[model samples]
Target: MYVAVKGGERAIDNAHAWLAEERRGDLAVPELTTAQIREQMTLAVNRVMAEGSLYDPDLAALAIKQARGDLIEAIFLIRAYRTTLPRFGSSLPVDTGAMACDRRISATFKDLPGGQVLGPTFDYTHRLLDFMLAADGDVPAAPEMPVDPAPVPHVMSFLNSEGLIAQETCDGTPAPDLTRAPLELPAARALRLQALTRGDEGFVLGMAYSTQRGYARNHAFVGELRIGTVPVEMEIPELGISIEIGEITLTECETVNQFTGSKTEPAQFTRGYGLVFGQTERKAISMALVDRALRWEELGEDDQGAPAQDAEFVLYHCDNIQATGFLEHIKLPHYVDFQSELELVRKLRRDATGQGAE
Candidate 1:
């Protein structure tokens, strides 16, 4: 119950002015450009793009700048701006197998088809902070290898051919658009994937960690993880042909879990899939774990009463925008509601003490 307070127009205006001044910071220091955020703060920009459900790096960089590095606020700005854009026709599904991979590795097999290409990763880097970067260090360029034109096959394909892993099949059913439609319960795998892809990274990571901590553990192993650029194509109505629209970098993860078998079906390894915009491997891996956890019913496994296994709970709370909106609204003025509660408590105390009404 919010009561309108109409006397703070000037205060609100001045507050906004102060916010703008603070966003600019000290005038002596060189102002950070959006390009710097896009390049230097690449991880932050990628996170914004992934959770905001928009892939425009420039807009994401600008939002980060405008929000003063508050990533959630930047995501809020992106989501709000996304609503106002006109809807173009949907593009065809990208072919991950045809991706021009920068990084590709397999935990299941070291000697896979494409071999391991550790393009750019922090896996081998020491975590010590370098003061040289603070003093504007000039880094030497990384050595480059000639681009491979051969198509990189998916690691899961090998297991599939050997009938060791569960095979995924498409029923030709169109996937639901969670943006246009409100999220409904008993969501299909496609809808859940949509929500998880744009879901809060922290929340998803926590949930996935819980699984590894023995809550609904599926004995998961990373089959393959790849980060690469894939071409996006859209069909033209007039021409009746698909044309390449653009390319976007993505991180894809495929996890193999414990085998499931029944009296009717042979035991085959289960799979968990994750795909996210940009090079967000952590989020992608987390998404895969949670995705598998939610599939307990589909996999004919007993529910372990875990938070990750509860679809309603996971889907409802995973959205950072919705969670933040509800949580932040309590900070708004609630004087009238508070006063009413105060009076009620006072009257109750007075009655308990046998005092006359005042």
Candidate 2:
């Protein structure tokens, strides 16, 4: 049982004042602005937005600033603020195929339609730390390429055309919103995807790594990975027409797994898909592998009892906010509960020793 403690109002107020002072650390140093965090710390802002399930970069940056760069805290602030906002209409599904890709690549094919375009990525860069950046030296602008007008075709489309890949079909059912309703098991693929996209990156990455390291191994290959901006559209009920709201950057990954076939059916390649906000390639790729692993039952593959294959385990623990809240609560006043436990232990010990309850 938990009990509330009183008579610490003065201490609590002092602690709050101290926290505020520490948050504004180093009076001599220039104060950081939300705009600076939004622009310079773009990746951090993106993470806050992604995990917080909000797309407002400005608000995310502000939260980051208030949280003093503690990302999970920033996410908590954003989520709390998001709860207070009024609901708006949902947007139409984004067309990633029509994305103005910043980076596009295929590992399966050497030369496919819409040739490889490596945008701003750190993949090929050496791990050496540049001292020049520390000195805040001026950097030259990177050369620009002419934008291609044609729509970029999905890499899986080629496989689909050849009847090599298992085709995905939609039943025209509206996808369930986990935000509105509590997560119910056995979740649909759409709901799983929703959870995965907003899941803690480190947790998802570790689960995905487990699959690659021979736990329910699915021989996976990245068919294509792309990052770009896609327009968001929402249909107005009064106007009865769809209008473009805005564009948001996204990273998309499609992984082709080893073929599965029955005696009567031809061997066909299976697939895993991941799409996430911003240029979070690692998170997106990890999401795909875990997604595929979780589909073991539906894909007719053996479960092998992998953690990633356990939907309840993955879905329940993937949320960092929930995990952190439970963890951090232990630091709060548990004195009454501890005292009860302490009394029980002492009584048990005394009983074992044949001592009186004096």
Candidate 3:
């Protein structure tokens, strides 16, 4: 057996020190504070929390600063830290119907019950460079008005009222935890969504966009995109009731996709759903599209061999953490395997020469 290179320990330590120096850039510049990162680089923090499957903005901000704004590295930091945290208990699913929305809009409906609240979106902004931001320019503050607490009901409810979509069924089966369990083939809705929520943003976005471009195009319309905090609760088995545990900010995107109904059932609109931590409507929307495409099998539609329609394909490639780790691990020593291939080639050459001589 070929021996491997030594000094991985010392090399790792030295690399870490170099990384720290690289992250700092210069000793002359003042260090960025955690609070500053959290406040100023909020979008980065939102991404880390969304991808890391954690809800702590503060921790995500710290991780981003430490990683020097390398989002993958920030995600790694958050994932590592999240693994260290204890799972005290599982909270009951948040009642998303009662979301106190900061931003609520529907592409399908021009007007809805709670009128759209376009809170803090860059949708209208030009893609050109904003040179003024380099010097911290400020815009005039708009009038601040408090939103009503009565809750904004969904636009899809109107369709549901007419029995156009499948009515939501509540079966008491406990959902599988992706983090704790290894992902298996043919994932259920809970498993697929869990993977999608923490999945790579860019990858999911591309897959989502592909649907629009006709890769398993289900003719999706954004049914709703809502961002808000929902109360988390836990069932007290002893007390026979659920108590409020805490709250988590979430972005939920529900898409209404066209479905040509099966022989057994009448034609009805199907749903594509995406829910992720933080105010990430883009990721949520992307996720919803992919989710709908993957449901071809369950909905009894033809797969058409599309990437988005393949459950195994989408679930496996969605997360960059896993993808990157596996892809990069190859950088480590593989001399033994290389030597084996070298020997095989050399032996083949020798045999060919010997046969020519004979």
Choose the strongest candidate by TM-score: 1
Candidate order by TM-score, highest to lowest?
A: 1, 2, 3
For model 3, the stretches where C-alpha displacement exceeds 4 angstroms are 1-4, 237-241, 350-358
lDDT of 1 by residue, 46-110 (tens): 99999999999999999999999999999999999999999978999999999999999889988
lDDT of 3 by residue, 40-60 (tens): 777778889988878898999
**lDDT for position 114 in model 1:** 76
For model 1, the local distance difference test gives 0.92
Report the poorest 10 consecutive residues by lDDT, candidate 2. 1-10
The TM-score values for the models, in the order shown, are 0.97, 0.96, 0.93
Number of colliding residue pairs in each model? 0, 0, 0
Ranked candidates, highest lDDT first: 1, 2, 3
lDDT of each: 0.92, 0.90, 0.87
Candidate 2 segments exceeding 4 Å error: none
Summing lDDT over every window of 10 consecutive residues in candidate 1, give the lowest-scoring window: 1-10
RMSD of each: 1.3, 1.4, 2.1
In model 2, the clashing pairs are none
The true-versus-predicted C-alpha distance at residue 233 of model 1, in Å, is: 0.6
Name the lDDT of candidate 2.
0.90
